[model samples]
Target chain A: MEKKSTEQLEAICSQVRRDILRMVHACQSGHPGASLGCTEFFVALYFDQMTNNPDFNLDGPGEDLFFLSNGHISPVWYSVLARSGYFETSELKTFRKLNSRLQGHPATEEGLPGIRIASGSLGQGLSVGIGAAFAKKINKDDKTVYVLMGDGEQQEGQIWEAALSAPHHKLDNLIATIDLNGQQIDGPTKDIINLGDLKAKWEAFGWEVIVTEHGNDMSGVVKGLEKAKSLLGKGKPVLNLLHTDMGYGVDFMVGTHKWHGVAPNDEQLENALGQLKETLGDY
Target chain B: MENKLDTKYTYTEKKDTRSGFGDGLLEAGRRNENVVALCADLIGSLKMGAFQKEFPERFFQMGISEANMIGAAAGLTIGGKIPFTGTFANFSTGRVYDQIRQSVAYSEKNVKICASHAGLTLGEDGATHQILEDIGMMKMLPNMTVINPCDYNQTKAATIAIAEHEGPVYLRFGRPKWPIFTPENQEFEIGKAWKMIEGTDVTIFATGHLVWEAVEAEAILRAEGISVELINIHTIKPLDTEAILKSVAKTGCAVSAEEHQFNGGLNDSIAQTLIRNQPAPLEFIGVDDSFGESGKPEELLEKYGLNAKNIVEAAKRAISRK
Candidate 1:
């Protein structure tokens, strides 16, 4: 229940990055690039930004809720949820193992404490967020809904469909963040499919667009999320474009799509862990 | 036996099953505060206007985004909201298959996917709008319950019934006006077969619009002294195996009828059930692995071999095989 400072949050982010690397390396499966990239944002939300209960109620009434649309980055989310006391941190070892609650993608079937729905399919979280936002409004709970999606996921037609309806329905209680890492599994997002003028696209879709240059920076994410939260009830859904690195903290894996899904080898994991401080003991 | 098999039941007026869904949804909203509705730009078509008007705050107009509507419906379930998504059968199942599969079915969210304009009975809208494979697609999902109610009364009861039940459900109804033979305000029991007539000759298991055809086929076969046992198998997934096996055991022959493809419709479920339990001589009356063209509802039914005559012929063929 102790409030975390910006420096404390950064240390947690580093530990989350380590958790992501170790979890993926242990499974020999999972997408680590975005998971590491969104570590700061996840830490900021769970530890600092989101007003949530660690007890983990499925409906999340009277509290801020978050959804992972680009569910491939579930390692980072699972790490943060466990670190934030949603469940025991020791459960991180079971990530992607048989009968593990932490699947490759976030799912609720295992009765995971934090996940509200199964998500790995792209472009679905925003819609689910909008629904939760609407539900909050109906229940007279003034809580906000946060969703994280991949830049590559914007190509999915359903994302645009959700984009058009969120603002139309005046879902100001909803705030969506896109990890603009500029890299996807195939290659660079521009080469795969350029998302020209993301800010313009969101503006045209009637959302209040906030473009942040430093998504990997803990202070920047905390600031951007605070600003997005401040803009609530303004009759516009907020869209935050967080510019981040694909393989953020790991030196060898950074700045490329090569590590988008591949797990780090034993030596590579040791090197990655060396860069990411184990401020909070490793799971 | 309680509902009098020998007495013939008929309706003076005909109504589309979709209207029953609309009425049932409105009633459900009235009954439960948690019942909510979502539509993918097909409110009028899905007969959801009444629900929308009555409960505008709870009703979500999701535009033409069937995929988003489905995911949102799944999300709504997290808050104990029983969301009923409305759209055409094609958009409901085929268009958003992965969305429903991942977000709703796999997540085990309590969602009701109310699909209208199902099967060839969708009339002149043609094959693109008329979804004949939705029942199969939905039934295959692990946590999905598939229901294809025959008439307005049955569809209404089924709609209201699904709202009370937990987990995901696919309620498939048609756009065309059909006979309303089932009782009004009847309690619809999920996965239970409705036996309209009991006979010794053959068991005619039908669903959706084809149930009416089976009724007519029963009347014709009864005149010819065939003595048919006409059973309405509304819930396709939890196939009333006991009812099917019991009826087929008594008759020694079966005819499965539906307004869907013969490959993966009610017939396929009945076949799987019979193959496992009481193996009986079976014939299928459905679209013979072909897409339907633009035509009247009645014409399309006749052309696709989903009429009373087709059921009668299938019954005779099954009896002969037996």
Candidate 2:
């Protein structure tokens, strides 16, 4: 697949951010801060980097796998899944309501097409990813495995356990991304629990580490991802620390913990939607 | 480190069921390439050392990470591999339940959750370590196959049988050694109960270590002119309802014994079976809804009413109800 230009990738991410705000607003209750924050990175993955068969059946024998360890941001994942043709874009309105396949957290219990495993209780997806990657290696398949974790979720001891296990197995085909968005539901991550020196910590576990600040810039993310993909199949695991502002596009929600879990009321919705273009039209 | 199972189930010295689990795991490594073992520490106790030594590549020491080990085992199963994960019963079921629920049972992964030191047999480990609820906890999984083999031969056979089957299985065993009476190379069948002895007076349904106690109790009862039928229920989930119903029909009374709690454990399954199909006068012999303290295995058994004496008393009580 040919790479998209920086401007085009940014345009797509802009559209995704717009979808996140509108989808959460329509539901009247959902997590939009992390969704809004991780748009560009996911957009780059879906449009530029991830080797996913969009028409995903749960068990893709030779296909690559991407696990959203921080599963509360289901809005962004669902939008990306729909936009990438895992299902119809029309199904986006069933975000959190009854009978909707799109649940509050990513779930396979509802039989959503793209999901392989259910994840909401945090700090365990890396182990799942490593297992998948290990299986692929055993089968001699060349597909890569990717997992994303929230910065706040780094407090979970299981995350480090999975992290240590990943590199110990020389899981060079697995790459984990940490969404270093400085806020969680309770408040800023620093106040709840400070996960100091994440790079040093990951490196200490024998992972080849990379840091990126271009969470909103598609070209930079795509480039970093390319380097990440190139480094795979080596003897060391890769850990990419992605720094991004929470609520990146919506000015009102940006940089504040209030927008993390609080649903935007009618007036607030209008203010938030004013900044984002209706690229693919609101659900 | 201990090679007690090298003989054909005829060892003089007694050993814990944890050692049996380790023995079976070590043998599984030599027999099949697809047989990979994962453990969250406790390698020596689980008796997985030989498997680790023989096929060092296939064994994964998952540290003290029970959740990750379960998830990884689930992932391993996706690639047509038989993964035997060893850990204490408490951590294997409750600590990482969500992980096992999502990654394994829900996904229908063919992983063997081999739990060691199950029930009150973990003795001095106290109530915290004595997971008498593992049988109930594991059977609750929709796709999980729960097995509690009686002794050395049955546990080893069940461990081998799980590899041939293609789904999730929870193999629960204990930390005490009473007797090894099951036949050698009998080809353990999943979900089928074995009738150790046949009689007309009463049926004593037992699993894990109690199978031996039930046998001993049957011998004593026979001397007293009481003809007792003995049934070893190795598989708890997909409970052997056919065998249970047939035996209860002939005897008209039944006794259910296990090293677990009576309410949600093996007794409940037997009660539910009888209530549905073959209702009989029933009395359960087990840890009656209470926590167990750390003690010698024999003392704990006597104190908790999970021994041969309790089985005999329950048999008499059940027959009187009839």
Candidate 3:
């Protein structure tokens, strides 16, 4: 398949944002804040950065694998996975519904094509990524492993344990991206639990840290991911600190912790959809 | 009744169940290329040195991070690698429960959670290190296979057997150097109880180090003309319900024993089975709603009412009640 142009990728990101808003709006109980926040990162990874096939395999051999650590943001992943031919685009309608493969959080028991592990519990995906990266090394596959976590999830002690492990094992084939949106449920992350100088923290933990100022911008995400990929195999894991608004793109929801998990009302949905534009058609 | 009990079961030497795990893990690593091992900084304690030495590439040393070890083990299964995580029973279950629940069991990943130093026999470590509720905690999880092998030989066979079976398994063993009575190369079937002795008076359902105590209790009861049947319940979940019912049907009374607490251990499971199928007089020979203190393994077992004398007393009580 030919590489998708920047404009085409931007169109996909816009559609994913629209899907996130609609899925959460339909359920009336889902996390749209981080889902909307990480729209460009997901689009950029799936559409451009990662080497993957639409023909999904559980054991992702000879391909770059991605794990959603902060799984509350499942809408964006569901949308990107569906839109990228992992499954039918219409399946996005079943988000969080009973008996639907699209669970509230990404799960493998439902046999969803894209998900390999059930991840709603924060601070587990990094260790999982390390294991997959270790598997790649064992198989000599030479492909990379990518994982995304939320900024609030850094408060979990297990994340710090994994933070030490990845570098100790010299997991150079792994790239971890944190959505530094500075917001979590109940309040702002700094108010709930301050993660002081994240870049310095990751650096202290021995990861090659890279920060992207414009996480919502498609071009910025693509470039930042490219830079992360370039720093691979340098005997250290890469941590990309992506600066993003908690509830980006939507006028009312943006820059607040209230919408972290609360779904928008009907009127709010219409308002958010009006801003996002149905570029690739709504699911 | 067709009795499969080994009447002449005996051992000249004793060995810790953890060594059996280490040896069996080495054999498993040799048999399957996909077999991989991970430890949370208890290399010497978990007895993974041989497997690590042989398959250096397959072994991962996850330093003092039980949760990360569990999560990584789940992740390794994504790439079709059978990961066996080793640590103390307390850390394996109580410490990293959410990790195992979400990543491994919930997803039905084929990961082996090999836990050593289980129960009050993790002697001298006190209640904090000794996990008397691990069996209950693990057996409660959906899609989880719980196995608590009795002796060194049985633990070895179980360690190798679980590697062949699919899905998540919690293989619980102890730290004490118990008598090695089970056959060296016996077929260790998951969820199947082994009859160590046969009688019609009372059935003693025992697990882990307590199985040997049950055997001793059988001899003591038999000498007093009170026939006792001993059944070794290795696997706690997907329990051998048929065997239990059949044994209890003949014996008319039952006694359950383990190195764990009575609340959620072998007795609780047996009580459930008996109540559901054939309610009978049952007595428990285990810690009674109490934590264990630091002592020699033998002294602790005796003090906590997990000894052969306690099993014999419970057997008498159960028979009298019947």
**Number of the top-ranking candidate, with DockQ as the measure:** 3
Error of 3 at A86 (Å): 0.9
Residue by residue across B1-322, what tens digits does model 1's lDDT show? 1222333567667899999999999999999999999998888899999999999999999888898898889878867899999999999999999999999899899999999999898999898888888888999999999999999999999999999999999999989988888899998999999898989999999999888888888877887889999999999988889898989889999999998888888989999999988788999998878888899998898878888888889999999998
- Give chain B TM-scores in order: 0.97, 0.94, 0.97
Q: List fnat, each candidate.
A: 0.75, 0.53, 0.72
Give lDDT tens digits, candidate 3, residues A6-120.
9999999889999998999898989999898999999999999999978999899999999999999999999999999999999989899999999999999879999989999
What is the full ranking by DockQ, best candidate first?
3, 1, 2
What RMSD value applies to candidate 3?
2.6
Model 2 whole-model lDDT (C-alpha atoms):
0.83
Residue B279, model 1: Cα distance from true site in angstroms: 1.4
Candidate 1 docking category? Answer: high
TM-score of each: 0.98, 0.91, 0.98
DockQ of each: 0.82, 0.48, 0.83
Candidate 1 vs candidate 2: the TM-score winner is 1
Regions of candidate 2 where Cα sits further than 4 Å from its true position: A57-59, A281-283, B1-32, B124-128, B276-279
